[model samples]
Target: MSSPSSTPAAPAVDRLRSWLQGRDLAVFHSVANRHWPGADPLLPQLSRSANHGLLWVGAAAGIAAFGSSARSRRAALRGVASLAVASAAINTVGKSAVRRRRPRVDLVPVVRRLKRQPVTTSFPSGHAASAAAFATGVALESGGWGAVVAPVAAAVAASRVYTGVHYPSDVLAGAALGIGAAFALRGIVPTRGQLPAPGRPPGEAPALPGGEGLVVVVNRASGTAPATASLVREALPLADVVEVAPGGLATALTDAAGRGRALGVCGGDGTVNLAASAAATHGVPLAVFPGGTFNHFAYDLGIETVQETAAALTAGDAIRVDLGRFRPGPNGEDGADGYFLNAFSLGVYPDLVRTREHWSSRIGGWPAGVLAAFHVLRGQRPLEAELQGRRRPLWLLFVGNGLFQRVGPAPGRRHNLADGLLDVRVVHGGRTPALRLLAAAVAGPLTRSPAHAAVRRRRVRIAGLAPGTPYAYDGEVAHSGEELTIDKLPEALTVYCPMPL
Candidate 1:
């Protein structure tokens, strides 16, 4: 067996190694070595204690004696029993068969200072195996609490490696064994209760019964947005609040349909896209509550303030909006094309998203915006693009359903969402240049100059673009495709808004 310092053979394994190296694991390992110098000697004995035996047995006993109800007690005991039996069989029988040695004990501080010697072979780490079994069992019992247990198991496994008592691969195998055992056990031990079937599939909306309840779809990560539940309670006291998870927008909408007539979504552009897709399919009137970082969708729709949007929802009126359908190129021959109700662009933006991780870390919004601007300015590059059905070779193309607030006097000034026409704005490289592009962006949305022109078209196609040209639709980059066809789905989506538009 190769040492942990040796390079991984598989591409996926190498990538995972690279990712781990970038995290704080290396520092954490060093700290563990410094604190627990004699930990290596205890690991073999620790592994023999039946894996997560100590934690699980203790928890099961506590729950059985003092749990609130018989159901809770039984669930806890069952989870513990499952993990214990699995851990014992795997650690004793499995490790005995495929005995492997620890990496050089003297290489790390924790191993070198071992007060007592270890006897068992270290191929499959008992510590990790036990942790995995316990965690998987707990996860099967309770999702929210299970999340907490799983990480502790991972940490125990990693500790084995940091202390130089078990090889990384040994811990990996132990984890797999434990997880498999837990899954096998769960097949026999059923969960306490049944959950309702998911209501809606993607692209379909739920049918609202009598149209009185308020359905809220929120992006939990969107900056400082009012909580969707709180907003719903304040604005529509009788409404139901539904939290939508990643890829759960359609289901949320479907579930909401039978409960309420009005649907309110509090999230970023991506959440808006999800709600919009479902609303359009179901012919439901939707309301937007901008909760994302940019609020680009709300901005395009002229819903600037969250308070104002909430007030409008309280008042209750519906409006029909146009939808954009993006048709990607066939055979992967051309750049990706799709319909966006807001704005679509290629270049700088996609690269920015790929690199920006500070958004989650920064407390206030200003820092994130400043960082985004810096990334855009520093990493900006020019790319050639051909508007297949247009007159010029374009550098940057922004297609929108509504007129952007004027950046300056640019050619495409009269873009309107309800006009049944798609607005196309193109920036030429030689005439406008990168500096001009930056200036135009800062000036505002409308740039009326010879270098930029806004043309109205019913259908538009873009092709002959360089590979990897980042195309952002409603702020998220589409996964893959080059050729794009943009067409309008007029009056397809019904939205709730304040009256007098």
Candidate 2:
């Protein structure tokens, strides 16, 4: 049934296949006969520990928990994601495609062989794929972590051959596939280093070597503030650190800003906002130590840990960032004047924040937020307010200090903190509040619809608000008056942040 050309190719293909199989078997026997003193007991146990990807999951958890920087957490998450992709491919496609039998363990030493052998195909090693995928993914995000993980991944791959469960060619193929999966994921979702850094418009600040003439005021009530503040103190032994209770933030921030050459804040966004205002008033550069539940401003500045801030202080690295402020107009005086380093919002979000804070102590932060969102959406009505000059019902209104751009499927991130524009987003009042919000979230930063609208402006005026309406800025909720004029002070504040490479 074969043609003349096909008949000639068939024999050549068969001969090549036989040669590769013979070489694979020869290498398998060579590895089985080899003996390493400590590897006898350790290889089998290490190979067993990687079963079902449990070892990689534990390693990712350790990296996330012990590593202090945002890069560490991101690297761990990416590693797990890559491992999942590699494992899925190996199990679903690779094994089924090639029904290769397991290598014979007759030549392998009894002490090196696994007590419970695997029943899967031997053409591709799942353990090697997972280990390589995890290590490569981590290294893509953080080279230091990659260096720490590569040796363990190599050992796991070698163990598969030593145990006689997989041939050397199978392990190599799986590792190649694993590395490919990591790069594929990177193509879909680029790492932070791949994106443009946020800090821009470099500003001058004092070079406080050994933390001389620096003071940090930490909010004790903020999440992990006390412990991280202790780390900051140890890292900057010469700097003055003031740990304050919830009620004492204003006084402590004022005192520290007044005396220190450079003011430092260790807490959440709300605490950072206070420090920024104080620093601006007293004319000093601000150093931020992220010890809060969500350090939005600090993370945006690319300074996630005290050590990074300390390094920046020593090197006098800093940038100029705009400050968002809302106040009453010249003729109006009822609205309170305040500044926000992150964002300001009204309507559903403010109510949600207030409700969440009310029940956060009883339950947990995440649980309370979920409960608050459900309760607010179910019972809350649309906020009737005047946007610019038109009166309309709105579900929510958000104003950011700088332009926010979406990265992949995640929330918006600011690449240029000194862009000098306010990102204004409004969700029009509709029948279903929950559906409107969900649609806005999915629409991303550039949203324009009957239900939602997004724009960038230098200033905005919202009037005709009902008295005592709740407003939130940087996670802190408070009451607002009938009208507010939101504007930006371009390049108003100088803060310590590392320059992008």
Candidate 3:
């Protein structure tokens, strides 16, 4: 009997590694021995600190610590998220599927070696992956902020090769993986700041009588309103633009709604809430021009600047949206009728919002929120209230207008504008309040095993509460006596925006 011999398959990965060594080793060696010495001795030390993307973590933390604008702060948070995705891909999948040896330190100068080299497979550089991921994530939010980090990220990725730990091919693979992770995240998460989504066309919009028939109520007390008011006037020359002080904003919005063919307003979420309520009540379309701090509603509408909203108004791009309505007390007469275009929060949340506002301007929103959480938690006692017919000890409760997607332990943004439901999240602190709250804060609002519960419903009622209990909606706090009934008002308001309602 003659036996046939079959040829074994060649190791393509090994072959590629050899070719990369031949092509890239000389440059890597040159950089290590000669080029890197001219750089600060701290270069490799800095690279070592970047192990597991800790350096990127610190950088994003710093941005969140110092950045005041919601855009920059969100970019920082997204950067950390991207790093998580990229690193998980690299360590758990990318590296495991294709194992490759690290460059031999025999050729690397002692000065260029990492203090503590990675022990994992070196097929793709994890540091490079993290750097690219973080930078791309930031870029996806604000190009200006992304531009600031690009050079640092490029340097960090290059340092992996310069420190004689990875091949150029490894860095290339890592960067590609990182960029892919960022794009993948874009699909998974709800976001604004991307190219504005086209909403309902002009033909779908309700009629606007004329320039005089349209009225815009601008809150002069808003930090950015004075400047924004000029632009609104310039854009809609014949539209009646009224400058109202903050104290009288609600009444002014109601008055403007009564007279105008279409209602427009400028301010923060609180002011917008007033306008949205009026617009919804009067059954008129709303033209929202962002002219306040952290324009949550405007951002959700995909209207970043005043000019964009004004342009949309002129072009007649608009959509119908949801409004969260609640009777703050048993009857409308007992308390002011309440409505929110964003969210409503009770218990420790209102305190945190107020506390965060005190310091968020100086240190930035994320850091301030963190600081405020700690402060609020220390002073906070559970609010005993009836939730959906059950009596429970609740640390905090949030109800959003539409179905909101969770980011960490809280709702970040809504997936739909008029889903005819309220997104309800309740936090239960249990016996160890701090530990439970912190865990719940990070584990995510919708996780199955979470200390909190997230659900969607058309209505919720709370009874047996103390008189004039304070709650927050649209970033402003108010008192509601005894019982409250929160309900979803689907497509209750028409909003002019770039995004679909």
Candidate 4:
């Protein structure tokens, strides 16, 4: 009884080790010879591990079992069910049609043991698809947890490569398929449960008479010197127009919500962003009364003039848009949180706010912005910032939920509100001359140009700089030194917008 068939086990283990060694050698050689040294060789390995059916099944089962309430349980089950269906459908219909090959076989292998007899068709990765679907389902049910699930699924899909099973993109496609399927299923089966017997759908107009109650958060220091409160009055009668003291928007919006169906915000991008954040939190739609120096949000949303925004309010066609939530970093206490509706800025823009605040009130916005640009060029240094866990030193960073200014000849092309993604602009700078800074500004909105490529992320984290480094949400500045964590709240706030643009 020394050992039952120890020799046989040794051969199997040796073969497996040999296979793994081959993959490692291939990966090392390919990566070493490549122009870019840091390209990840383990990606394929991780993707292959992700696609194992057992992993997804376990994930679904775990979510379903631990759900607290019946509703929660059902929602969790529905998500898992949806993901499975979607994953299968996408694999059969979408991936099968494409029939792409795995990158590991086509390119290089990091672990040879993980490699197997290559499959003929490999458009999408089943592992990635299943992982994605399950992850998505989990996310929809769990809110912030969904963000976590996606990456876990991504890792699982990556394992496919380590296991010598799928390509990088195959896993990606699978994840997409699974997530899409889950969403489709959720749409079919309402999260709130089934409807009752047929009754006429609610009428298009308001059930109650359109109330005269409106609240306006007017930033007194915004643009061409606070365009007479009288003008705002004429534009919005029956609305309580509160003149917000500098740094009073949060309280003003909370107070306004206690009294109205909609809150109108009058100011620059910063003001609108602040008001919108509050409005979204209170589950109210925001009506824009563009009075800011650079009404970028309004301009992007196609509300060209103050008059147009006012007219839309009169017409009462408000459309809903997404909102973002910002929480303090892990080390901070709870309840030290704020939200933003349009964009969040770090690094350069924050510096601009600090510089601009020092300028006299008589200066116009464009001139102030120009002056700020020059000041930043001459004095401001690029700050080290991290996003979605990736650390990099950057000149400026912007995270926008809905609309953003397009650069070049076309300056105001709007990104749709329903896309469920955040547009991140990272401006890279290195001790460039003042003339070059001016040249960059003259080039138009930095985000759209090739010089300032926008990186999109769902959850963004900024660190490696002092907290008091003045940051603005929309246009209002948060207290200096507050750490910022901005995350997308998809389809959280709804509004009525004019159809057909």
- The 0-to-1 C-alpha lDDT of every candidate, in the order given, reads 0.60, 0.88, 0.77, 0.60
lDDT of 4: 0.60
Model 2 pairs in collision: none
**lDDT, residue 137, model 2:** 97
Model 3 lDDT, residue 132, Cα: 93
Once fitted onto the true fold, the runs of candidate 4 whose alpha carbons sit more than 4 angstroms away are: 1-211, 224-228, 330-335, 403-412, 433-453, 479-484, 495-501
Stretches of candidate 3 exceeding 4 Å from the true structure: 1-20, 26-71, 85-126, 141-148, 159-166, 180-245, 251-261, 281-283, 291-293, 328-336, 386-393, 407-409, 424-430, 433-459, 488-490, 499-501
lDDT of 3 by residue, 1-501 (tens): 533543243467678867877877676666667664455476676677787678888888777655535677778988889989998988789988888888887667777777677787888888888989999998888787899889888888888887788877789899999999988887776345443443332325543423446799999976467788888888778789999998999899999999877889987788898898888888778889887777877876667776777666665667877778888654434556678988898888888889988986687555787899889888568888999789888887888887665544554556567778887878775666677666655655455444677777788888888887789998888876789989866677887765353
**How many Å off is the CA of 440 in candidate 4?**
7.7
Cα-based RMSD of candidate 4: 21.0
* Candidate 1 Cα misplacement greater than 4 A, ranges: 1-211, 226-228, 254-260, 299-307, 310-315, 330-339, 353-366, 389-395, 407-416, 430-433, 442-451, 466-468
What does candidate 2's lDDT look like per residue over 207-256, in tens digits?
A: 99878999899899887689998899889999988888989999889899
Tens digit of lDDT per residue, candidate 4, span 279-348? Answer: 6768776767666655666644555445555565666655555667677774334446676766777767
Ten-residue segment with the worst summed lDDT in candidate 4?
Answer: 198-207
- Ordered by TM-score, highest first, the candidates read 2, 3, 4, 1
lDDT score for candidate 1 against the true structure: 0.60
